[model samples]
Target chain A: MSALLAIEGLRAGYGETEVLRGLDLVVNAGEIVTVLGSNGVGKSTLNRTLSGVLRARAGAIRFDGAPIERESCAAIVACGLIHVPEGRRVFPNLSVRENLDLGSYARGKPRRAQNRERVFSIFPRLRERASQYAGTLSGGEQQMLAIGRGLMAEPKLLILDEPSLGLSPLLVEELFGLIKRIHADGVSVLLVEQNVVQSLEVADRAYILAEGQFAMSGPAGQIAADPELKRTYLGL
Target chain B: MLSPVILIPVLLNGLMTGAVYALIALGLTLIYGVLHIINFAHGAMLTAAMFACYFAFKTLGIDPYLSLFVLAPVFFALGYVLQRFVIGPASHGEDRNMLLVTLGLAVVIENALLVNFRGDTRTIDVPYAFATINLGFTFLAVPRLVGFVAVFVVAIALWLIMSLTDTGRAIRAVAKEKLGAQLQGIDVPHIYAVTFGLGTACVAIAACLLMPSYYVNPGAGNAFVLVAFTIVVLGGMGSVPGALIGGLTIGVVESLCSLFLGDSLGQVGIFLIFIAVLLVRPQGLFGAKA
Candidate 1:
């Protein structure tokens, strides 16, 4: 399979301090790639830079064989790289349905109604609470809504930033199951997470990020099996 | 006397005036809803709209009612450009920066008006200026009656725009979550400009409605601005319906207070109610979420 999203020599950071230094990664089409990192390792900064919200200090980002390093957030989304940001940033005042509908505001315009139904089927709780404001939902329900909203965009490559955040262990299991089902639909998944064990179970490959670069990279099962790798790097 | 015959006219007068006040506050509230900033330029913008209305009538013989059609769009475009190119870029979506930017804009617009107009109070001589609706108890000016009716129409129109249109949907989404809105590919700057334009258009409509009954000068809008700010706060910052009800309540209170305590001191009734509401329910008449 060809690379759906490819990054080489990626570097980005806030002013005067670099966080992501010469990082290289690839997510081939129809694959689940997990980027596991500890806090302050710049997982969010990497996501932000890839999504074009943060300007990449220096990088070449190829998405579907075209350079998108200079594209705007809107342009990146239009090209079908949907980023479900951390913290489940659903519109609080807007109803669940409105939140889902807004997902296709830029790209999947023609298939908006169709995609919304598809999203609802994936997250039945969202359908039940369709009329309720997003902020009023339970934490798990809000995360479901956030993912459902992202699905409504018809993303070819879905970058989920810490999807299991603040979710109970039971809910995390369900969220991972949902992620697998989403990936089964031919959408490449880039799962960025601090929940390393749960993420590796779902991801086909895993990349451990440490101090702004990948410390170890390989198949998820292989990475999880290596005792020295786990002992020195993962602390597991 | 507290008799129905005497008090009813005063209440009616207050309601009609309150309708116009509601429209003015609606403009301010719309801006606050989307931008999360109390626009310091709102009064100056109103003064500017009043001058435009006056010029449309005096120089071109366009009736104030008819000029609403012309002036609203013009001001809409002006507001769109102001927010899009000026406020949006300068403020970078920060609330404090927006406050400063709008405040600076207000100073510039007011001083520009003062320099150009020379502090002269202007009024229009519309043929309908003296026309009145003869209620059994009192005569209400026809223009004020028209304003009372038109404010509802405008409110309904604004409501429809906010709830129904795609642009409105984008606007609401941005107001709630700018980052999420951007991720959805909604052009945030465009929505901010559209919202500001819609708010300014409301001011234009208010200017047209007021021109028939009110006098205008460089500082004319300053009188409305303070009361509008109070209504925005009392109504809850972004609630359109809240502003409407709050304005009417304040208007009636002001009217009844004046009947007992003369005119100048009577205006304090609005502030008194404002303080009471803030003290009792800090969220104002409506719950605070925009």
Candidate 2:
């Protein structure tokens, strides 16, 4: 399969403290690749660097075969690389509909109406609360709204950062199902998640990040069966 | 005396002045909504627009009313450039640094105006300046009524832009959530510049409306900005309609207080009520409760 995104020698951090150190990764077209890490193994930093919110000190990032390491966040988004950030940061003061509308602000302009309807279909709860301020939504609804927003861009790849961060197990199940549904529709996913078991269950492949770099990488089934991963990360 | 004849005119006069106050406050409120900074340069920008208006009439033969066509777009461009190049970069996205940058710009702008205009108050000789609408109770100056009508028109236009346009939607999104806006591919800095430009355009419009009815000097704009700041807090820091209603309410209060108390004491009376409201509601009338 052709790769949709490729990263090499990626390094990033905040003010003299390195967080993501010399990591290399790839997400193939139409693939679900989950990156699993505990609380502070630069999972967020990796997502931020990929999305261009955090600059990489030394790395080469190519999206759709074009260098995008130096691109601005807007340009990166316009290239159809959408990131649904952690914590479901919806515009609290804006209505759910407005949030969806802005999702097409940079890309998918002509298809905004159609894309919004698609989002609503995928997350019907969002449609029910269409006019409600996003801030007032329950946690599950906000995450759904956020993912729905990312879909509005007609993204080539969707980067989900900890989509299950604050959801109940049932909601997380629903979210994973939604992610599978979204993937079934032809968009690649780079799922950065902490719920390793569920992640491995949904992912075609998995990467375990520890100490600023991936310690294990392979097919999802193989990584899931690894004894060290079971003892250290899975606590099985 | 609280006679109808006296009371009626005071109310009318207050409403007229309130229009100008509302215009100024609208600009301040918009900037605060987006940048979350008080924009210390706001008053100075108004002064600059006033001086520009004065020169357009004095040096060029453009009437103050006609100058609206020129000043608004020019000041909008000026504000855009200021925020895009100067404020955005110099502050490094820190609110406190933005405050200092705007404060420093205000000082520079005011001093520049002072050096050029030199403390001399200036007014133009438009024939409409002396004309009045003679109500049976009292006669109101034509310029003041024009200011009232013009402000409503501007406010309505602004409201339309905010509610009906894509840029406006993007702006509101940015105001409420900067990161979410960025994630959606909205250029946050561009939106910031656009908001500042829109705010400055409002100031330019207010300057145009104020010139025929009022005077211009380096310090004259400060008199209005202090009140605009009060209106912003009273209206709520980021609400457009809030600024409008808050400004009018403050205007009527100021007028009534001055009527009962002497001019200096009236200023005290306004503040006393402002404190009372803060102590009671905390959030202004239109502001959402924090």
Candidate 3:
């Protein structure tokens, strides 16, 4: 199987300080690949660079066999590369239904109604509170709404950034289950997460990022079983 | 002592003045809502539109109302270019810089008009300038009535566009959350340009409507700008309906104060109400608390 997204020598950062340096990664079709890293390990930066929110300082990023290194964020989204950003940046003023409708502003506009129905089916709680303002939702519900909004775009590759950050343990398990279900629907997911064991359980392959580069990479089960990795990063 | 019969004409005149004020405030509020910038150049843009209509009347003998077709597109294009070239880059910078840039733009445009039109007051002498509509109880100036009706039509059109169209949804999305809009593949810079264009178009329409009754000068917008600001603040910074209500309220207040307190102190009453609104409900009558 060929890769859906390929990045090589990716370098990105804020002004005068580099976060990601010479990072190389690949996400293949029909797989869940988690980039596990602690806070400030450039995981968010990676997602930002890939989504074209931040300009890649120096790198080549190819999505779906085309170089998108110079593409605008909107253009990248038009190609079905959707990013559910960190901190659930849902439009607080807009209703749940309006937020989901806006998700199809670019790629899924033609099928907005159909995609909205699909998202509503997937997240029935969102459907129940469709008219409620997004800001009024609980943290877990907000996360679900964010993901559901991303799904409204009909993304080929969905990049989730710290989706389980503020959710409770029970909600985290449900979110992981939802991620697994999403994968089953044939969407490629790049799960940038800190939830080690849970992410390992769901991801087909895992890469541990440290100091702006991959420290260890292998099958999920292998990484989870490694005594050194469990002791050092996972804290198991 | 003012008689109760005089109150009727004062109220009718207030409504007419309020309609024009609503048009100006709507443009200011819409631009502020979407762009997150208090556009100081809005008044200058209105002045530019007035001048454009004036020139069209002088050269082509086009009636002020008919000149809307020509002026709206021109001002819209000017606004688009202004946003794209001047405001877009500065938008991402400091709020202070955006404020200063718009202020500077206002100065430049005002002075340009002063140089071109030589600060002389100009008014289009339409045949119905002094015509009055008799409603048995009150008399309505023909131009003012037209402007009053036009304000409702424009307001309804804007509300419909915002609620019904895809482009309007995208604009609202951007105003609410810009990053989310971009993630949805919205060209945010393009949206900004279009929104600025729409705001300018509103001013163009206002200028055309006011041509018959109001004089056009380089500084004509200065007085209206102060009132527009008051209306937008009173209506809420970004609320369309709020602007209309605020405008009407100010108009009535101005008329009543001028009647009872004398013309010299009319604005004093407006300033007091403005201060009271700020002290009591800083969000304005219709504004959502931020």
Candidate 4:
């Protein structure tokens, strides 16, 4: 399959502290690829770079055969590469419905009403609280809202950064299950997380990030069965 | 016993003055609410708007009210470009950079005007500046009454736009949470410019409305600016409804104080209320309970 997003020697950072140093990552079309890493391992930096919040220094990022190195955050989003950032950045004071409306702001205004219905179907709890302030949502509900918002853009590839962070074990299972369902629907996803076992369980392919670059990457089942992964990440 | 004849004009005057105060306060509160910066230049912008009206009226001979048709959009465009190009980039982050920048702009505008116009206080001398409506109980000054109607109409229109429009939703989203709005693909710089434009447009409208009622001078905006700050603090910063309630409340109270104590003491009296509101409920009367 052709790569939906290809990052080659991606170097980026905030100020002088370089977080992503010569990183090479890929998300192929019609696949779920997880970038597994520990805290501060530059997984979020990678996500932010792709999302255009931080510009890449001395690297190339091609989305669907188009070089997007110079595109703005809004312009990148308009190209259908949606990023659902960590900590559930829902517009807190706005109503749940309004937050969802903002998701389609860049690319999908005409189908906003229709896509909102689609999101409501995927997360019924969001519909019940449509008029309520998004800040009042539980951690899990906010995660759902964040993903639902990503879907509202009708994205070609959805990059989710630490979706399972701060969620309960059961909620994590539910969230991973939702991710699997979304992947099954032919949407490409770059799932970045620390939940190695659970993420590898559902992901089509997995990249193990140590330091600022990929240490290992392969089919999910193979990565799950890797002896070092068991000893290092899973502590089995 | 005071008959209805005596009581009606007092009530009319209070409502009319209250309306003008509310209009000016809306602009001040809007800037305070979304930008999280006290735009000291706001009153200066109001003065600028008055100047725009003067040029439109005196040079072109358009009536002061009719000049709003010309001046409002011009000021709106001016506000948008100014906020976007000059203020937005320099005012990023948690620092008080935006406040200082606007304050500096205000000082510059005030001094520039002082040099150009001298210290003479000028009022728009339109035919209707002297007209009055006989309201049976009290004779309502035509200009003040017009100002009252204009305030409510503009306030309601703005409220509707903010509540209902897509652009308005983007603005509300930004005001509520900047980072979240950014992730949602809201171009925050664009939103900031639009918010400033909307806020400044309100000032433009107020300048036009005030032309027929108050004297126009470089220092004139200082008086309304004081009252506008009081209203924003009292109404809760960033709350539109709070602006209206806070403004009208300040207007009536200030008028009543003027009646009882004298003109200068009225402002001193209102400052006490600001202090009391800050002490008791710093969130302001109608602000969202955070």
Candidate 5:
């Protein structure tokens, strides 16, 4: 299948400090491609670069057949390449429903009402607290709202940055299940995470990033079963 | 001893003054709330609008009330351009720098007006400027009453727009979280410009309304701007309704002080109340705790 997102020689960083150096990555259509990394491995940086929040210093990023390296963040979102950023950056002052409503501000505005219903159905808890401020939600619920908001954009490629972070084990399992279900519905997901075992279980293809480079890449099963990767990286 | 005969007119006059203060302070508070910068040049903007309204009246033979239709959109566009070119760039820099820039703009505008219009006080003498309406108990100046009613109308209209519209929601969202709003595809810069324009529009309305009763001069804005700042702080820095309440309260206090104490000490009375309020409720009446 043709790639839904393709990046080559991707280099991005903060002032005077390089984080992502000469990286190449791809996510094909209708697949959950997991990018696994530990702390300070530049996974979040890659997500920022892809979402156009951080400008790529040197790279070519083709998303759904258009070069998006120079695209503004809003333009990238208009292309249905939605990024549910790290830390559940939900508008704390806004009600849950308002946050979801804003997800379609750039794209899918015409079907905002219908998409809101779809999001509420997927996240029944959001519907329950629809009128409550997003800041009042518990951590797990906030995470759900973030993903629900991403879904509101009708994302063709949803880039989730560390969705499993700070969730309880039960919630983590539930989140993985939710990802799998979302993927099954014909949406491509670029899952950037630290939860190796759970991420590997659901992702069709996986890449382990270390020191700003893809240290390993293959089918999910192969990466999970590789004894060397297990002993060294996964610590299984 | 307070006579009801003497007190009634003082109270009404206080309210009328408060209405004008509230109108001006509303713009200041709104700009401060969203931009996170107290626009010191707000007074200058008001002064500029006063000049614009005056010229429209003098040159085009437009009534001050009718001139609003032209002045409002013109001021709004000017505000957008100012934010896009001047304020937007300085916004990303230090807050102190933004403050200095606005202060400089104020000086520049005030001096420019002085250079052109000179120091003479100019007032638009409409036919009804000195006319009064008998309210049974006491007579109210027709111009003041019109301005008083117009203030409430503008305030209510602004409240509805902020609460009911999609654009308002985007604006509020941007104020709450810029990055989150951007992720949702809100153009932050565009919103900022619109908000700045809205703030300037409020000033335009105030300028038009004031032209009926008040005189316009280069320093006219300076006189009101200080009172507007006090009202904003009293009401809660960013609260629209707060500005109204604050303005009224200050107006009543000023009137009462002028009645009992003296006209010169009226401001002293306002300062005393302001300091007392700050001591008790630093966030102002409506401001949420930071």
Candidate 6:
């Protein structure tokens, strides 16, 4: 399958600290590709670079066959490469509806009403609290709102950074299930998560990032069966 | 009927003053809302616009308010370019830097006015400046009434622009969350400049409106600046509605103070209110919920 996104030899850093070093990755169309990593291992950094929040020091970011490494973050979003950032960065002061409305500020204004309906269908709780401030949401609900806002953009390739972070085990399972359902709808996903086992179960392909480089990558089942991953990441 | 001879005119003048105060505060609050910067130079921009209008009238003999159509866009472009090149560069991710830059701009403008115009207060002598509408009970100065109405219209228009237009939505988005708005393809720098322009445009409106009623001088800007700051704080920093309410509140308070005490102590009383309100509600009247 043709790749929706291809990052080759991607290197990026903040000031004196290099966070990503020669990281090669790919997300194919209609596929769920999870990047598994421990905390502070540059997985989030990869997402930021891909989403144009951080310019790559040296690398090629090919999104739908276009070089996008030097593009501004706003330009990147206009191209439909939506990144649902870590920590559920919802506009705390805005109402739930306004937050979702702003998501379509890039490329989906024409379909804002339609997308709002679609998002509400995906997360009914957001609809119920549409007028309420996003800051007051429960953690899980805020995560849902963040993901819902991302979906409002109608992304070509959704990069979910730490989607399951700070969620209860049950909510984590539900989030994973929802992601799988999103994948079933033929939307490509680049899932970054520390929940290695759950991510592996849902993702079609998996890459293990350690120290800003890909240590191992293959079919999900192989990454899951590898004895080293469990011992190193899971303390098995 | 009976009271305006004794009290009605004073009340009317108070409301008119409140209206003008609200207009000035609205500009200040808009800048604060989007940029999180207290624009120390906002009053100077207003005074600058007043001078621009003054020249437009003195040279071309055009009515001051009529010249607003031309003057507003001129000031908007001026503000946009100023924010883009000068203020934008200085505001680099630090609030203190922004504050200092605007304060410097204020000083520069004030001094420029001093050099050219001297410290003399100049007034726009429109034929109607002396016209008064005689109600049954008292006489209402036509210029003050017009200023009051203009302030009301401008306030409503600004609120609508922020609520309805595409650019307005982008601004409100930026105001609420900068990064999140940027993620949605809102050109942040452009938005910032546009916001500054819009804020400054309010000054143009106020300056045009104030021309007939007030005197213009180098330090005249300082009067509105102090009152504008108080209004912004009183209304709630960056809160548009708060600016409006706060302006009206201060206007009425000042009027009452002037009525009961005198014009000299009116300002002192208003300052007292500012202190008491800040002590009670640190966030001001319409500030964001902490």
**Candidate 2 lDDT, tens digit per residue, B40-105?**
999999999999999999999799889998999999999999999999999986867888999999
User: Which tens-of-lDDT digit does each residue in A20-46 have in candidate 5?
Assistant: 988888999988999998999899999
User: Could you tell me which residue pairs clash in candidate 1?
Assistant: none
Query: Across residues A1-236, which tens digit of lDDT does each residue of candidate 3 receive?
Result: 99999999999999999999888888998889999999988999999899998899998999999999899998999898999999888988788998898888777889989989988888899999999999899999999999999998898999999999999999999999999998898899999999998999999999899878888889999999988786557545
A146 Cα displacement, candidate 1 (Å)? 0.5
State which candidate, 3 or 6, has the greater TM-score. Answer: 3
Extract clashing residue pairs from model 2: none
Q: What is the per-residue lDDT of model 1 for residues B109-138, given as tens digits with 9 covering 90 to 100?
A: 999999999899889988889898777778
Please give the distance, in angstroms, between residue B282's alpha carbon in candidate 5 and its true position after superposition: 1.9
- The clash count for each model shown is 0, 0, 0, 1, 0, 1
- Per-residue accuracy of model 4 over B1-290 as CA lDDT, tens digit each: 45756555655676678777788889878877788888888889998889878777778888878887778788889889888988876777542787888888899989999999998888767889889987655677898888889899999889898878878888888876776677667898898899889888888998888898777888888888888888888998888888888877887787767766778787776798999999999989988766
DockQ, candidate 1, vs. native dimer:
0.76
Error of 4 at B94 (Å): 6.2
lDDT of 6 by residue, B167-202 (tens): 887888788777667666678888888989988988
Interface RMSD of each: 0.8, 0.8, 1.2, 1.2, 1.0, 1.8
Q: Distance from true position, residue B157, model 2, in Å?
A: 2.0
Candidate 6 local lDDT, residue B274: 89
Q: State the lDDT of candidate 1 residue by residue for A32-100, as single tens digits.
A: 999998889999999999888999989799999999999999999999999999998999988998888
Across all candidates, the chain A TM-score values are 0.98, 0.98, 0.97, 0.97, 0.97, 0.97
Q: Report the candidate with higher TM-score, 2 versus 5.
A: 2
DockQ (Cα-based) per candidate?
0.76, 0.81, 0.74, 0.68, 0.72, 0.60
Kindly report the fnat of each predicted structure, to 2 decimals. 0.73, 0.86, 0.73, 0.57, 0.62, 0.55
Q: What digit string (tens of lDDT, one per residue) describes model 3 on residues B23-113?
A: 8899889988888788899999999999998888889899998998788888889998998789777766554566778898999999999
- Residue range B70-177, candidate 5, lDDT tens digits: 888899898888887787787674545667778888899899999999998888878888999988889999878888898899899888877667677788888778
Segments in model 6 whose C-alpha atoms lie over 4 Å from true places: B1-5
